[model samples]
Target chain A: MEKSAGSVGKVVVDNISKSYDVGRLKEPVLDRCCLTLPAGQLTVLIGPSGCGKSTLINILAGYEKPDSGSITIDGAPVGGPSSDRLVVFQETALFPWMTTFENIVYGPTVQRERLRDEIEKDAAGLLETVGLREFRNKYPSQLSGGMQRRAELARAMINQPRLMLLDEPFRGLDAMTRELMQEYFLRLYEDKGQTSLFVTSEIDEAIFLADTLLLMSARPGRVIKSMPITLPRPRVPSMLTSTEYLRYKEEALDILHEEALKAFEGGSQAAADFVEAYEERETVG
Target chain B: MSLGATSTNAASNKSIPGQQVGEDWLYRAQRALTTPMPYLGIAGIAMFILFWYLTTEYFKLPRFVKLPGPVEVWTEFTNPDPIYGTSMYTFDYYKHIAWSSLRVMLAFALATGLGVPLGLYMGWKKKFKDYVFPIIEVLRPIPVLAWVPLAILMMPGREAPIIFLAFLAAFFATTLNAMLGVESIDESYFRASQCLGSTPWNVFKRVVVPGALPDIFTGLQIGVGVAWFSLVAAEMVSGEHGLGFLIWDSYVLSQYPVIVIAMVTLGLVGYVYSLLIRIVGRSLMRWTQKGQA
Candidate 1:
């Protein structure tokens, strides 16, 4: 509701670099990664394991500072975490002490920004939206993996953040559940046009939800490809098999395969077999 | 509800096997009751009592020649003015129980009151921990019994010394464990709390306190156990009208049966005290307990 036409919901990562000192050696994780996610777009970044995808999300969420670069959200410089930028962590980070409903209401209740009745109504709607109405009183540990992820989504969404940083938000969900969740997520964000940066390792998931698809290279990780997924909205399962989808998938896979080869840092038989086997597998779906 | 129909390749792999425990509650409880362990526990206690009786009285074994039998202790436990020099009838027995229970509760409550907040602050504030932790570490290792002399010298009255000793005994474990409780929290929870725009004070109240609860409960149980230990030791050495003094006085008079009565009474009371702590812990951590964790 607070959307400003020119500036709101835009994320600009400029020459951001980060490294962790392992003993005396500085292990470079992000190598001057630079990208701009346009306002109100869902951008997905896909890369091989340990390519600093999580680190990038953390930096964007203002949980960590880049070594020598700036990150701006909606023209304002990013500082330590604000309500405007919320992250859904990969690990089920729902407070173990709080129930699913309690977790969803935690943000506004803590900030005391809304009236009690408004918060209660919004919480009811959020729980309903995530299909967790019956599981409201259940603790995070009691919920199934998919349920926990949905609860976390509701928790983050209630904050109504300008930018949502999802660090593989659907990582461990069963494939069928993952598919359902993707559609559920797309439908939720479809009309809202909320800006989000989604990180993933799966190729299909990256293409399915992204307005802009950025394939990341191995660590020191950087954006290798910045292609747009021009697939039509309200995407059906059949579009996954379309020629345009396969064409986009093939180009993305080539970039990923090259990145994987580079990730290995040498000629390994497993790496060679991996890309070959991946390409040969029947259908992108 | 039927999200499992379309089996996923890697997606199914995301869920760790054996994470879900979907057994019926009644079935699980019935199954647990049917186990050999609970029956064995009851049988074990009966066998222990039988062994004590046989060795002391029935068999009159060489090792048990001097010790009082269970029968003698039981009889002496009821008599008003026993041969063992203890007045164990209605008023005398209740008086000792009341005194000891009163001292234990007061000391335990005081220790918890001071220890919990102290630990929470120490855990939350780095500067406070750095300044105080070394002193706490040094004092904790010195042992509560070792401080009996200092406690007596520090306080004037008999009641004050015993209470002081009990408080010190419980304080160290409660404080140290509460500190450890905060330290044990996962780093991600703190990050999550901060990202949600929680102020430092709110973080301390919401995240630090509740997050450290399970460990704090563990500390409370240990603290109460130590409080009993120190209370008895303090009463035994100094002038007092408590269970510990009764045990020592009976020992001095060589009233072995009365000593056993006091020991048994103390054991039953101490067991109940720890049980109370456990009951409180369960009620507080309903969110943690009902789940698999």
Candidate 2:
């Protein structure tokens, strides 16, 4: 295991801005969004729909470039995609033609940095870790939606990337499956302590999984608030009901509620839902 | 019957909604035989044959007066001493089948060999597509039969001209479909490949080829059918020993029953070619098959 120091995984996004030209109009998505993913920590980015969370992840993964401003990982300027930063896409991008084991072994085999036997051995362990050992021979289409996601995780993990970018990785899963996946993900993250940026829309999911929760403003998005969760390690379901957890949730909700109203004025549906959720929480509390 | 075989082969080794796992081919064949669809198809063919029989033999209608009855055609096709000098017992019947089949196979092979690579390159590179696509677009709309005269003029031998016509028909279909196949692949797959440390060449090898296979096979299927269609047309126009020539020669001799036999032979051979392509497609694309159970 090529174990580097924890400091090696720091990622810095400095004054990044991106926009798409929609016919005659220029649609600004990310407006000088700046944030840092500290080494050996999971940072959760939550915001309203169309808030450019995915765009940030895309830029971090080096799939797309920012209009102006730069991104760096551990002081080195990031260019195109490399094995150092692996992204688990929201829609499960496992190659349909390749089996689960084959997808997991793809990075090492293609890069040719590891021995063939060594790559296979590590891939086998990753498959086991992700609980997809039984489905090693199954293609992406053959696996269920959740199984496919797990297979993708294993595929990315085998590369031992310094930073992991998850673009709403558990978005479409059913409630029960989504909860289970979150726990499963936290377990893996705790074991490796790799720098991870998790982008999501769900408030509970953002609160439960993140070491630091960074909430962004509505479109032309930029990080508006960064709150560190002081809850103890090996977080449990019991923590959800704890006073400290509620305190943090309340603090986060207050900031998000203000931003949601700004978004609601601009005709955003997700912002309306957030306001509604905040009002319901206030009445109940 | 050939339609039933093709469908069954496509549905084979697949766990479709209504199909049972571990079911043998014989059992499926039995099911096909007993199905309402097959019965309806048989009845339809029987009705067509009955209409032909009534018009030519029973009614002796004025419009069908020149055409031979089903019985006469059948008898002539099966006879050891055919008056038309072409029958199941004659070596010339087999020779015609061989010539047509060989020419179509060669043309299809050549088209696939050249067209697939050309299309893949065109799809992969924007500059390559810009340089080549306009010529193909202009050439493709011109019918394969329209090239028959030019093909004969360009090529020296009878075989070359017929093969050239067939090749042109298959090439356009194959190349266009393969190009569309590459375009059909999702943008995310390419992004995923690049993120996983694949080089430009590896991306082409790993992402482009397999991702485009289903469409490539579709192209192959359409191409093979067109190859047969153009081969027959080419043979009919030029000097040849193929089934197309056999049909024309029988007509010139007024061996009307022999002409019907040749048409039937052509239909059977074309169906077999499509069935072969479908079977190969199924075998190569096991990943496309749904749940194993």
Best by DockQ: 2
Provide the TM-score for each candidate, comma-separated. 0.88, 0.92
Q: What tens digits encode model 1's per-residue C-alpha lDDT throughout A233-267?
A: 87777889889988888888878888777776643
Interface RMSD (C-alpha) of each candidate?
A: 8.3, 6.4
- The native-contact fraction of candidate 2 is 0.65
Candidate 2: give the clashing pairs. Answer: none
- Stretches of candidate 1 above 4 Å error? A1-7, A266-278, A281-285, B1-37, B80-88, B291-293
User: What Cα-based lDDT does every candidate model obtain?
Assistant: 0.81, 0.85
lDDT of 1 at B234: 89
How do the residues B1-293 of candidate 2 rate in per-residue lDDT, one tens digit apiece? 12222233344335444445435445644553355357788899899999999999999999898998999999998899998898999999999999999999999999999998888888888899999999999999999888878898999987899999999999998998889988888988898888899888888888888788888889999999999888888888995699989888888989899889999899889877877787667555667878841
Positional deviation of residue A155's Cα in model 2 after best superposition, in angstroms: 1.2
